[model samples]
Structures are given as C-alpha cells and as structure tokens.
Target: PPRKNSGVLADAMENMATFAALLRKEMNAHEDNDHEYRKLEIWTRGLISSLDELEQSWFAAAFYRKSVIAGFMDDMSPVEQGDYARYVYFYKDGFIRVFSLLDKLGTVLNHFYDLKTSKLKTHFSYFTVLRQLQLLNVHPALADQLEQIKNSYRDPLENLRKRRNAEIHYMNSEMQDDLWQRHQGLHDKIQLEDLDSHLEDLKQSLEMNCKTLIAAFSYSNEQLRKEISKPKSVQS
Candidate 1:
C-alpha cells in the first residue's frame, strides 16, 4: 500500500512553488537582475526535487520498519532480516539527504545574500554558512530564526550527523551499535536499537528542515518584493 504523504512535505512543496512563481515574476520585472534571479531559480528547483526525494526515502523507511518485529537478530526470520536491511538502507538515505538538501539551500542563500561564504573556505557547509550569517550580521532576522531552529533540534541533528559520518566514513551506522554491544561483552546475537525512537528523531529533523526552508524562502521573497517595488531612485 502506498503511504500517505506527510503534511510537512506537502506544505514545503507548496511554499517552494509559490517562491518559484514569485521569483519568475520578479525576474521578468527586473531585467537588470535577471542573472542573479536565474541562478536563484535553478537552486530553488533543485531544492524542490531534493525535498521530494527525501520524503520518499523517509516513507520507504517507515514502511519497512513496520514489517520488522524482531528485538534481536537471533529471533528474526530471514524475511524479517531482509525487511530490517531495507529499513536501514532507506533510513540512512533519509538522514544523508537531509544534510544534502540543507547544503544546497546554503549555496542558494550564499549567492542570494552575497554572504561570500566561499571566500572563507573553498568548500563550505550549511553550518558554516549559518556561522557566516552570524559573523557578517547579514539578515539578522533570518539568521536568528535559523539559529533558533537549529538549536531547538540540536540533539536530534547531532545524532543524525554522527550516524551520517559513521555511515559515510567508518561503517554502516546500524552496525556501529552492534560494534558497541560487542565491546560490552560478546553476545550470541545483536540487539536492535529503538527503531521507532530513531525514526521519530528523523521525523523531527525533517520537520526542522522544512521549517528552515520556509523561513528562508519566505523572507527572501519578501525582500525581493520590496526591492522590486522601490522607486528607481531608491533601487540599488
């Protein structure tokens, strides 16, 4: 059965569409700024697609998670093992995409606000961009809002980041728990972590991601409209 899409995902998609429409309208109105607006348009499109993929991965993970009833590897049937593997795959994909989407947004914000984050580092991340926002004191309202969102979800985001690093650099994230268990004492079978709790954390992170995106694009849209409406003498 197809899982129902989350409202958070749906709202983000809707807001992105509105932002795109406004951006195109502004692009046509302000011919002198077409180049900058065009770049923003491309990034916005990419964000929309990336967000859709993240939601799909999350849904697939939830679907597979429901099929696995075993508390430990020793009690699982072969089918349950396969289901758990699928769950882990999609879960990992979901968390990795969460950061990937944010970094892509960082690129957009960097160019949109002329933050010059690239000058600070050849390759910078979303967190770095956030820091630049604070350091530069550009768009203080947006920066404060984003900072609040990040801080509110700090614990979950940190957990996801550790899993992401482990999955990418060390070993499969799920296996990290198993490795720790082995250090505790040799066991006949591996115990499963709290899958539901982990998924809940991922869900919270996704909500945080959606809120950050909305805050950013909404503020940008307002600023763009103000810039467009200003008299030619006042326009920059």
Candidate 2:
C-alpha cells in the first residue's frame, strides 16, 4: 500500500524485489505513518493508479487502431482496400504507429498536402473526406488550406468523391468499377503509370494526411498556448 510512479513501474521484471518482503515492508511502513503521511500516501496512490490506467488506455488505443486496419484490409479486396476510406484509415493508423502519437485530423491533412507526385494521376476525391474533416472543428483558414490542398489537381473528382462517400457512409453497392468514366461530368482518366506505384502514392498521401492534420493542430495549439501564457493586465 505504498505510493509509486507508474512511469517508474516500467516493464523491467528485475526491478521488483520478491513479493513477500515487499508486502511486509509496506505493512511496516504504513504503521509508521501519521495523518499527513496517510494523506500523502493517498494522493501518491491515486496519481500512480491514474497513470497506470492512462498507460493501459494509451497502449489499448494503439492496439485498437492496428486491429481495425488489419481487419479492414483483410475484409476487402486488395484493390477495394486501396480505395479512399480504408486506405485513409490504414495510413492514418500507420502514422500513429510510426510517430507514436496523433492529433485528430492534423496528421490527415498533412499527408494530403505533402503529396507531390506527378508520375501518375494527381487527382483525389477528397471533398467528402474534407467535409467530414471540416466537422472536426477546422477554422475558416484551415478549411481554406484544406480546400487549397484538395484543389491542386487539374480535374475535380466531385463525382468520384460523391460515389466514394456514398459507398463508405451509405453502404451503396452500385458504385462499381469504371462507373465514373460513364458519367458526363467526369473525364475519369488516369495516367499510364503502373497501378502499383499509384496505389503506393495513395497510401503515402494518406499517411501524410495524418501528419498534416497534426501540423495544423500544432499551429492552432501554439496560438492558443501563446494566449494562455500571455501576462494578465493588473487589476485597477
């Protein structure tokens, strides 16, 4: 019943003494304490317990994202899984795996904007994703940046975006292969580059989006922190 820092409780099995002696020490140590020691002990216990729970939850989230990606990839055709929604989730989750952290849409937008490939199709049907992203408390300026980010392509993927969104959100089964080319609004074409590189870029951009969203949030947070840290005017 002693307080401990969970950070210090690390995964080192060697750090722990034998259980019997440790417990006996705790029992003896508790008997030596007064009211203040008991209070300090209570707070330390809470702090360590809370930290332990937080660490568990943190690792749990990492495991959950990886599991979701694995399940999603396993369920879809390699081609189908390469499409927008699943690929975005895959890369976003991947960004967390690589960076050891995440910041909402911060990582998402960064990857989108960071894309610079002209070796194949430069188009992306990002409207729905951006609209969804907009719901994550994006500012007008950030929205503008997101818009500019999506608008970099020579052609708009509005029809494709609509179809992808419908497929993802409405579970529409009709948006099947090569349907966009049949639509009048779309010149739906891709450059003659191999599909493998195209898919790789798609995934790379998704990962970059994860990083971009993080960058955007960091900027916003820095601004907020500056305001919070500013000195308050003296009261009259």
Candidate 3:
C-alpha cells in the first residue's frame, strides 16, 4: 500500500478517460499557425497512444494472471511444467509493461515541460523529468502531486527497475546471481521461484504505473483546458 493514499488510483483512472475526451475536444475546437498546430497535434496523439498502450498492458496482465491461476490447478499432472512457464511469462509481461509505461510517461513529461533544450543525447528517464519539474517550480501543485507518486512508487520501482535493466542490458532477470548461490548450498535443493511474491510485486508496479499516468495526464489536461478556456485576447 502507498503510504500517502489508497483511493487515488481509482480516481486517476476515471480522470484519464475524461481527460482524453477534453483533449480531443480542445484539439478540434481551434486552429493555429501550421507549425504550432502540427506540433500540438503530434504531442496530443502521442499522449493518446501512450494511454491506450498502458490500458492494453493492464488488460493483458489480467489475462495472463488468469492463465497463471488456472495453470497451477493440477499440481502433480504433466501440466505443471506449463504452469511454471506461464508463471515466468506473467512476470516478464508485467515487468516489460511497467517499464514501457514509465518510458511513455517520460516522453510526455519531457515534451510538455520542454525539458530537452539541447542537442545532447540524454535518456529521458522518469526520474530525470521529476527532478526537472522540481527545478522548474512553475507548477507547484503538479510538482507536489508527482512527489507523492514518486514516494509511493519508490520501493517497488527500485526492484522493478533493476530487473528491467537486467532484462534489457544483460541477461534474463530470472537467472539472478543470488538464485545461483542458493542452488550451490549444501542441500543443493532446487525450488520453484515464489510466484506469489512476484505476483504481489507486479500488482504493486501496475497500480503505481496507473497512478503516475493519471497524475501526469490530469495535470496536462488542466493546463490545456486553461488555455482553451482563456479569452482569445488572453490566448494571444
């Protein structure tokens, strides 16, 4: 459970749907210089795409979870092998979705805040944008909200981040050095990895990812709505 809040995740998901509708309405309700309009269009499309992907990931994880539960039913049968495989598959899918969702959020944050100012090639990590938000200090409410998310997500994200890096940059995350150490013990007992623990972590990661996206797009939607609500003279 997040130390700060529990109900925010549900509210955030609801806000996302409303926010997406407002975004499209704003886009269609106005016109601007070709370059500026094109840029906004592209950015808005990217955000919508990211949101769609995030939702899809959550749904897919649910499907995989069902398969995992059903797979474990006949413990002593030949299907046990397939069940173990499905268990690993769930973790893999969950971690990958978690990482991808973060990256998508990073892109939106970077673009919305104009965080990238130079030609230097730097990875736009989620933390990178959070630090930049603190330094900018332009949106105090958003900064504070993001701070809450960062705090809530910190511990689980630490574990997920390491596993994601291992999978992307090195080798299979399941083949950890610690697991090898355990296998080398005097008893030399090989036990199945703890599916329950992995499931809990994955659930936490997914929840956090949803909260982060909700906070971010909620902020973005507020800003855009403000722009649209302003008088034409004020907009100019």
Best lDDT goes to which candidate?
1
The TM-score, computed over Cα atoms with residue i paired to residue i, of candidate 2 is 0.29
The TM-scores, one per candidate, come to 0.91, 0.29, 0.75
- Return the number of clashes found in candidate 1: 0
lDDT tens per residue, model 3, 28-82: 7765545443454555455455545544544454454544433223343455556
Instruction: Please provide, for model 2 over 105-147, each residue's C-alpha lDDT reduced to its tens digit, 9 standing for 90 to 100.
Output: 3223324333222222344323434554565544556666656
Backbone clashes (count) for model 3: 0
**What are the per-residue Cα lDDT tens digits for candidate 1 across 7-94?**
7676677777777777788777667444877778878999999988887888889999999998998899999999999999999999
User: Least accurate stretch of 10 residues (summed lDDT) in model 1?
Assistant: 1-10
Higher lDDT: candidate 1 or 3? 1
Report model 1's TM-score to 2 decimal places.
0.91
Off by over 4 Å in 2: 1-144, 153-163, 169-175, 178-201, 204-208, 232-236
